[model samples]
Target: MRFPSKKTWILLGLSIVVILISVSPLLKDGFPKNHDSELYMVWLSEFDEGIRDGQFLPRWVPNVWVGYGSPLFNFNQPLFFYLAEMFHLIGFSLVLSVKLTLILATCLAYLFMFVLSKQFFGRHAALLASSIYIMMPYHIGLMYERGAFSEYLAMAFAPLLFFVFYRLGQKISYKYFFWGSITVALLLLSHNISTLFYIPAVFLMVVLFSKKILNII
Candidate 1:
């Protein structure tokens, strides 16, 4: 196994530091006031109940819409809530779980962006690109301002999907194909709107690299 070089580790450490600083606001005593934070907390609570009641992937959260119930999960993306549920099951409070999920998404966004950037650019440039990606106003605001957890998680998958497709464009292999498919699935589950937006870009990439794809087939 080829381990990262010393400089690569340093760059990764720096990236982690940047991610930590950017998410420090989440470390506050309570959830930050945001548009959707309460809504996510409610959803997560319902999801937890569903899980305990043996509904692995709950579509109808029983407590939503004044107990009349809403098929919220059936229509909305559940990936983010699923992740928060994992944290919740592990003993964290629902609010903390939600915050942790956002923090995790921030870390994933940096790591994925770094790996994708490093594939084309050097480690230093990758560090810069990832730092910028994690610190983008909209990226930060998604968690701290809007509490758009699903969309935020989707952002983490975007670069990973691009990296996978870019590799397949160069050379098709079972490894790349498997990862590409998984990335697409994760992105689709993460956010519907983001997936719709990304489809065009992915198609463009496929078109640009059609010759290579054809040669492989």
Candidate 2:
């Protein structure tokens, strides 16, 4: 069977440590138990039921809005609930699951920032970028106070999406295109408001980068 290499394990360990530190406030309370955090928990029932019934992707939340229901799965940012369910399946309490999802997103943001930066600058620059990212006040509020969980999930993918798009320009490959599209789609699914803001910047960057790539070539 295929397995993770030693270096992969080392990176995973280091990432876990960094992510835990980012959510250090959570360790004290075992994670926030109320506010906007609670609404996400209220939505988890459908996901839990869907998992057990083997109905893979949920389409509706049948018990929302005083039981009138909602097309939650149709419009909700899915990655948060999906990641939270994985943590739940692994036996964490629901609150902990949501918190862990945030931690996981932080880990990805750090890891991808490091990787993408290393390509442009070097290892030291990558470390600096990742450090700055986790240390930023906006990230702190998003995780600790604002409880902007879905947006956090989307943020992790946004940088990676841009990096993958840039890589596609350097080396034309179907693999790069496939992964790039998936990243863009994930960003779109992450948050409607965020996606609205992202679309214009994305199109502008594509045009600008395409021109730069052609000039360099």
Candidate 3:
């Protein structure tokens, strides 16, 4: 007979709590709510412009006016744009389109964090780690705000990246290596700043835990 692990039960409980928090924001008529009115207005205007010019990437948006005169691109990733474009084509509200993507990304992040954390630590550690991640200050700060979707999505990728690395080290497979590299690249693409922040911390953790770190030249 199969029995659910304590970790599984903890995750199930946390999942319910997170769902409630996420749905609470949707009790209103639209995305961003009145609390983040300016944030939504900015993204909505950019969505209109992107549709007018027919670009999948948010190129030189006037309202998201931070990257002007700099070679540095919009911190936002193309995946969100791609997802939003498809929703726009389907006649969904721009606000709803972005919200939907954000919600999915957020949920995936939680799920991945649990799975990944469990790979290294047991179920108890995994559930606790995942709970911390979902309640992270950065996520809470930027989750509903506009133009920060890339960071939010990339946040989820970080756990998956670690999980893949942990599995690769366990099995020592070339295919895992390839997939791990791809995950890292995607993280960089989504949010270079986050990659920058995560890379050092991840590297330090890896060095401390990975015996192979000393085996490599």
Candidate 4:
């Protein structure tokens, strides 16, 4: 196999550093915690039974007051629960489950941002942007203290959705459009409020860079 070039090695190294910084706080037990983390744990515990029975009970519940009735539960959409089901099947506790989802989302987002930046900006800019994003104070605060798992996951997918669209517009194809639409749908489902705003930002970027977009495959 061909070895990675120096630039590739450098970016990989930076990405590891960024991921460590992004996730370091969660490893500590001293930080303030989110109350919802407890509730989510209760919900996640039920997911495995749902999966085993071939039906999620929460879906069948009439009231679903735990979260569905509240603004927070419906703040965006129901995608987070669906995403969490995977961990539920694996028997992760609520706190671990939420953190796992957020950490995975954060990692994916950083990686995608790096790819997007490299595609649009350049390797150096991509590395810098990803580092800054992973190291951002708000993200750390939210993941550790606020326990904004849905927002974290949604935000992670946001960059990838844009990256796919950026590539899509360059060359129209069924796969690109379909996947782009799926990502948009997932984004909407995960957090509609964010998606409501995200969609426009993407549109403007495409409109503003119509020429350059055409050059990328």
What digit string (tens of lDDT, one per residue) describes model 2 on residues 129-173?
887787688877777677788887887777787788777766777
RMSD of each: 2.4, 4.0, 4.4, 4.2
The top-ranked prediction according to lDDT is: 1
Would you list the C-alpha lDDT of every candidate in the order shown?
0.88, 0.77, 0.69, 0.71
**Tens digits of per-residue lDDT for model 4 on 87-139?**
75577655665666777888888987888888868778888988887678776
In order of appearance, the predictions have TM-scores of 0.92, 0.81, 0.73, 0.80
* C-alpha lDDT (0 to 100) for residue 101 of candidate 2: 80
Q: Compared to the true structure, candidate 4 yields what TM-score?
A: 0.80
How many clashes does each candidate structure show, in the order listed? 0, 0, 0, 1
Candidate 1 C-alpha lDDT tens digits along 151-177? 999999999998888788778689999
User: Which ten residues in a row are the worst by lDDT in model 2?
Assistant: 29-38
* Candidate 4 Cα outliers beyond 4 Å, as residue runs: 29-32, 46-49, 60-76, 212-217
Q: Comparing 2 and 4 by lDDT, which wins? A: 2
Report lDDT (Cα) of residue 91, candidate 2: 94
Q: Please say which candidate is ahead in lDDT: 1 or 2.
A: 1
List, residue by residue over 124-203, the lDDT tens digit for candidate 3.
78767776787777675567544477777788788888877767655578998898899888888777788888877766
Query: Which of candidates 2 and 4 reaches a greater TM-score?
Result: 2
